[model samples]
Target chain A: EAGVAQSPRYKIIEKRQSVAFWCNPISGHATLYWYQQILGQGPKLLIQFQNNGVVDDSQLPKDRFSAERLKGVDSTLKIQPAKLEDSAVYLCASSGEGSGNTIYFGEGSWLTVV
Target chain B: SQKIEQNSEALNIQEGKTATLTCNYTNYSPAYLQWYRQDPGRGPVFLLLIRENEKEKRKERLKVTFDTTLKQSLFHITASQPADSATYLCALGLDRGSTLGRLYFGRGTQLTVWP
Candidate 1:
């Protein structure tokens, strides 16, 4: 079966510019997540979507980061007025219903804010 | 909030030897824990999962042991290989109400097996 799919494997933007990453999860998976992984650190969850509804987004910086999973299949994560500190890999992952947290991840979208 | 800790630095060993990694968590005892393998610049791949009730679980040459008393988990790879070199991450599944099954990760342990 095909794994999670992400776009723009790499991205670069100015500090004040905006950037967005897209994701297409595995077929039939109902749970989708976006995580930010900095160098030398584990993936930190930014948001989670169960179907089209948000399950959790406590860690996301609402002032800058926004994500949407329209129709519950495709998701987009956006970072506006990007900061130099926003440079990191944006990883999209998915898990099927009743999978019990066994998430499968995409390769990731690398972002470098200059 | 749960704080998870993995082997803090890189572990290097010769090929054909066994490599063991540790993960410790402070606070509540998770109902289940998971391990993942992440290569440089890539996303993590699911490796294994061990439940609170399960003392040990194995797959091929990989084995995982969970000890609730010590609040730790041990991951072992037998007959290590160069291809096994990567960052290994341990995740705790938070079993709260709306956040049930949410995962929190530890700083991974980098393991390198040289020929």
Candidate 2:
């Protein structure tokens, strides 16, 4: 089976600019997630969507970051007025309907804000 | 808040040897734990999961042991190879009356196996 798919494997943006990353999860997956991985750190969840409805977004920076899963199959994460600290890898992952199921991740979109 | 920690120092082992990584968590009781392998510039790939009731789980040459008393998990890779070199992450799943619980991940342990 095909794994999660992501776009723009790499992205470079200037501070104050805006950037977006796209993701297509595995077929039939019911849960989608966006995580930000800074250097030398684990993936920090930015948001989670369960069938287009948000499950959790407590860690997300609402002032600068936004994400949406329109049909519950694909998702987009956007960051406006990007800062140098925003430089990191944006990883998209998906899982089946149960808590025990393993989550599969995409290659991730690398973002470098200069 | 829950806090997870893995070894910050990189582990170096010779090929064919066994490599063990440790993960510890505090301030939370997780129902399950998961392990993942991540390579440079790539997202993490699922490796294994061990439930709270399960003391140990194995898949091929990989073994995971969870100890609730200590609130720690240990991941072991046997017959290690150079290809096994990567960052290994441990995630704690805390249930909240949902089929899928939220995951809190550790910083990860980097393992380097040399031939």
Candidate 3:
């Protein structure tokens, strides 16, 4: 079985610019998540989607960050007016329905904002 | 407000020895906990899961013990190997109205095995 997939394994952007990351979860998975991993820290969940409906997004920076999972298969995370502090790895994860939190993560998209 | 913590520093161990890591949480009464292995520059991979009622769970060479009373979880690897070197993370499944499980992860503890 294929694992979670992410695009642009690496991304470089300038402060004040815009950047977006994409994720393709495993087949038949209904729960999708986006996490931000800053250096020297664990991945922090930014948003979660359950079949195209957002279940949680309490940690996301609504002022600058947004995410969408249209149709609930793939997801996209976007950051506008990126700041230098935004530099980090963006990881996408997925799990099946009622799986009890056994999430599978993607390789992640490394973002460096200069 | 829940907080999860793992060792912030890396653990260096000799090959063929056993490696053990600890995770502690505060202000959370999780129903289940999970462990994941993450390599540098990669996403974390699922390792094992242990519920509140389960004291221990094991895979080939990996074992996890969860103690809810202590609010701690321990991850152990037997017969350590160089390939086993990676960061290990502990996650707590938050109860949010029976919604799909949402996890809160710790910073992770890096383990390095030397031959």
List the candidates ranked by DockQ, beginning with the highest: 2, 3, 1
Cα lDDT, all candidates: 0.92, 0.91, 0.90
Residues B1-115 of candidate 1: C-alpha lDDT, one tens digit per residue: 7689898679999999999999999996688899999998889999998989899999999999999999999999999999999999999885744334468899999999999
Q: Pick the candidate with the highest lDDT.
A: 1
TM-score of predicted chain B versus true chain B for each candidate: 0.93, 0.94, 0.93
Candidate 1 lDDT tens digits, A7-69? 999998999899999999999998899999998888999999999999889999999999999
* Candidate 1 residue pairs in backbone clash: none
Off by over 4 Å in 1: A98-101, B96-100
Q: How far is candidate 1 from the true structure (C-alpha RMSD, Å)?
A: 1.8
Candidate 2 C-alpha lDDT tens digits along B1-115: 7689897659999999999999999997998999999999789999999989999999999999999999999999999999999999999888745556468888899999999
Give the DockQ-based CAPRI class for model 1: medium
Q: Which candidate number maximizes DockQ?
A: 2
What is the DockQ score, from 0 to 1, of model 2?
A: 0.73
Off by over 4 Å in 3: A98-101, B96-99
Quote the positional error of residue A111 for candidate 2 in Å. Answer: 0.6
Q: lDDT of model 1 at residue A105?
A: 94
Candidate 3 lDDT, tens digit per residue, B1-115?
7789896568999999999999999999888888999998789988898988899999999999999889999999999999999999888886645554568889889999999
